[model samples]
Target: MGLRLLIIVALFLVVEIYAYQAVRTLFKPKWLLISYALISLFLLVYIVYSFMQFDRAVGQTQHTMFVMGLMLLVYLPKIVITVILLGEDVFRLGASLVNYLMYNLPKNELMPERRKFVSQLALGLAAVPFLSLLYGIFEGKYNFKVIKQTVFFPDLPDAFDGFKITQISDVHSGSFDNHEKINYAIDLINDQETDMILFTGDIVNTHATEMHPWLNTFNRIKKYKYGKFAVLGNHDYGEYVTWPSQKAKDDNFKGIKNLYGQIGFDLLLNEHRFIEKDGQKLALVGVENWGKNFKQAGDLNKAALGVNQNDFKILMSHDPSHWEYEIKEHPKNFHLTFSGHTHGMQFGIEIPGVFKWSVAEYIYKQWAGLYENKGRYVYVNRGFGYHAYPGRVGIMPEITVIELKKGSNVG
Candidate 1:
């Protein structure tokens, strides 16, 4: 592990060196250059020290989050500069090789001087992410976008033809620093006035106490006619931290489950509830966090015990990977599944309808938005809050409002 860490640090230093070449080419003042290097060195040392000080028992905290934000803000742009400058080096190497082979140039003078325009271009490109990350930390995390999606199900219960369900997932309440913004987001959800509200969870980072301050804030969410419901997320299980004992972990898990009820939500734990409208019943089945890479505590069969395969069902599971790996192919034939956990990797370019891309796409097939497989659909909410990085980039936080329609075609 020590060797691996050393290798990673070495690579990080190499990227910094390559990135600095861009700055050196563009600037000539020695004092200014020395100041930049000193600042970079200080940040690198502090970041490494902070990471080394991280306590697994304590898990994520404001201090750690700040360090993570700093690490990303410092390195991501540098990586961009590194890649660009490295490409220039490759080209320069080829030119030097040709000069040596064809013109018999001396080895000492074989390589040509680096182009100023190339450095300028690299720095210009690097500025994009640097500014974006800064904006993300200060504002984008709270940039809540209401995404309305109307899904058509041929077998949708007739009485619930135009049912509107608002979903907010991956709350990660522990990471919230602005109550005013959260209240505004809550108001936005209330303004929708959807028939039902579903939260596919991560109510806290690792400890239930992380959500205590936000209790009344979240409690402000008005009750929906059909009711508000939620299911446990992987984080709610407190799996990320090292517990003193299993009982302590169990106690925290119990507290996390109670947080939903405190917020006026009926916490569903491998259970199902039927919402009846005009003599027609639609099944709402919820399972505990069942992630392909995380936990497998959710029991789908147990949750859907009373509901038949033909029943119109909407399943709420925390991780989208659950739907992709197991539920999608399950015989239960859930009409729709709501999930969050990917958070669109909290970074990616998403141009609605025209183009969408995230690093998360490589991991989960249904990373964001609505995805369908043989009439069964899953809508993955980008997230309601930010986590590790403490901010969002291109993919803004989401409040997904889905309307259920009875038809073969989706609008």
Candidate 2:
């Protein structure tokens, strides 16, 4: 880890130096150049210091946000500059070859000096992402968007027709910095007034204590007629942090389970529950965290123990990979599944019906939105809160409302 950190720092320094040189060439004033250098140096030093203190300060929301904000303000812009500089170097190399072959020029005079216009252009282009990132930090993170979808099932009970279910995932309450913003988000969820609510894991980041500060605020979520249900996501298992002893870790897990209860959630651990209306029932099955590369404690068969294969079943699993690897292929067909572990990588462009894409797509096939395979469906929520990056980019936080219908319309 130390060696990897050194390599990252060295690479960042190289980019910083290149960016500094570009600024120096653009502005010939010594004072301006010195000022830019000092600012860059300070940010770089702070980044290193933040890395060194990460373990100790990881629980501090302000400290984490500060370090992440610095990276966005300084490092990202420099990376853009580096890309532009590298492109110019490629042009220079080509020009040098042409001069050597045609004019027999010396290596020193083969290529022209770096263009001031190029530096200016690079700076202009770099501002685009820097500004976008700033917007993400200030506005985009709290830009909660409600996505509604209607799923049609031929065998869906008539009583469940038009039954609305609100789903939110990956709260990661440990990373929250503002109470008002969170309260507003919770209010938005309640505004949906869905019949039932389903949370697909990740209430906190690492430890159970992370949810202590926001317990009351989240507990204020309006009650659903069918009640709210939740399942464990990989992060909720207390596996990321080192505990003093095995008992401490077990206690932390217990506390997390208790927190869900305090929030009025029926926390399911490889279990199934029934939501009935007018003598018609649908099975709501929830399992522990299961993923390709993450923890696989979730047992589908165990969770489906009492669930009838013929009944319309909605499975709640944290990772979408579980749906593809296990749920989809399981002998018993599931009408729908809900998941949100990817969080769309908390970044990406998603224009409904036009185009939806994110870096997370490469990692998880069903990263976001709805996907269907042989009548089995899955909807991966984009998440309700931000995490490690401290802010979202193109992808904003999500609140998903799904209404189940009894029949399909092919038109």
**Which candidate number has the best TM-score?**
1
Candidate 1: residue 386 lDDT (0-100): 85
The Cα local distance difference test for each model comes to 0.94, 0.89
Query: Tens digits of per-residue lDDT for model 1 on 1-411?
Result: 799879888988998898788889989899989998999999988998899889999999999999999998999889998998889899999999999999999988899888999899988898998999999999999999999999999899899999999999999999999999999999999999589999999999999999999999999999899999999999999999999999999999999999999999999999999999999999999999998889999999999999987899999999999998889989989999999999999889989999999899999999999999999999999999989998999999999999999999979
Model 2 Cα lDDT, one tens digit per residue, 301-387: 999998887988999999999999998878889889999989898778877789988899999989989998888899999999887
Stretches of candidate 2 off by over 4 Å are: 56-61, 409-411
- Top lDDT: which candidate number? 1
Task: Provide the lDDT at 386 for model 2.
Answer: 82
Reference-based TM-score, model 2: 0.96
TM-score of each: 0.99, 0.96
Worst ten-residue run, lDDT, model 1?
14-23
RMSD of each: 0.9, 1.7
